[model samples]
Target: MKRQGGFTLIELVVVIVILGILAVTAAPRFLNLQDDARNSALDGLKGAIAGASGITYGKAAIDGVESLENQTISAGNETINIDFGYPADLAALEAVVDGLEADWSNAASGAAILFGYDGYNQRCVSYTPATGANVPAVTEVIEGCGTNF
Candidate 1:
């Protein structure tokens, strides 16, 4: 009789069960959902802000206020105040996007949020008003994955 170099069905089943148990108990520790979510949210917000700034610039150009400071542009039902063809402040950025204030808070004049992060300012996005033919700056502070938002 020749010995087979293969696992029996019972042995394979036991291996699979052990793997499943380890996956169940260990996957969560490896996959950090909260950090992923916060990073995604911040990225989405940065896109929205950049887009809104462009739209505001277009409107400002049409109205001949693109180079001027402390100007207002009509966007939908809201009048967005702008500076140098982009949003003037955090309030102006918030005007175009809804649900931002729910999780985000103003950290400074041109920055937003201290979103329950374990690391130092790794969960915030900075928004600077445009000036001198420059568009508004939207950036995320990326450090590393953390415990929660």
Candidate 2:
């Protein structure tokens, strides 16, 4: 009698069971990565908005543009609308950042806009124009971002 060069049926079954268990344990971690990625992207957008606001404000000051509603100033190659020497609205913030795509909604008071990414339904970046001597504010909301993806 010759022994076959193959796994026994019991051994194969055990191997499959182990693989199934591993997959069951690992699946959730992999599934959650998409949400993590979306959160990270939103964080990056927040940083970009803050940086753009600062740079645009500096440029407006250097060019002697008065800090007033509806005034526009050149920042790098893009024009940023100003509200008291800060980014005026969502459009101005989008202009400063350039090439960023998101859904925008006006805030209740119309003093800010909420920019949300398509896949990240709950996550948003809020852009609030400066009031009085205060600088513009950019806030990121990652906690309420839906995990539909």
Q: Pick by lDDT: which candidate is best? A: 2
Compute each candidate's TM-score over C-alphas: 0.66, 0.71
Instruction: Assess each prediction's global lDDT (C-alpha) against the native.
Output: 0.68, 0.69
Per-residue CA lDDT of model 1 for 1-102, tens digit only, reads 999898899999999999999999999977987768867877787676667767778888999999888889888888888888877876777787676666
RMSD of 2: 4.0
Worst 10 residues of 1 by lDDT: 109-118
Query: Could you give the C-alpha RMSD of every candidate to the true structure, in order shown?
Result: 5.4, 4.0
What stretches of model 2 exceed 4 Å from their correct place? 1-6, 64-71, 76-79, 101-110, 145-149
Candidate 2 lDDT tens digits, 24-54:
9999999999778867776787888788778
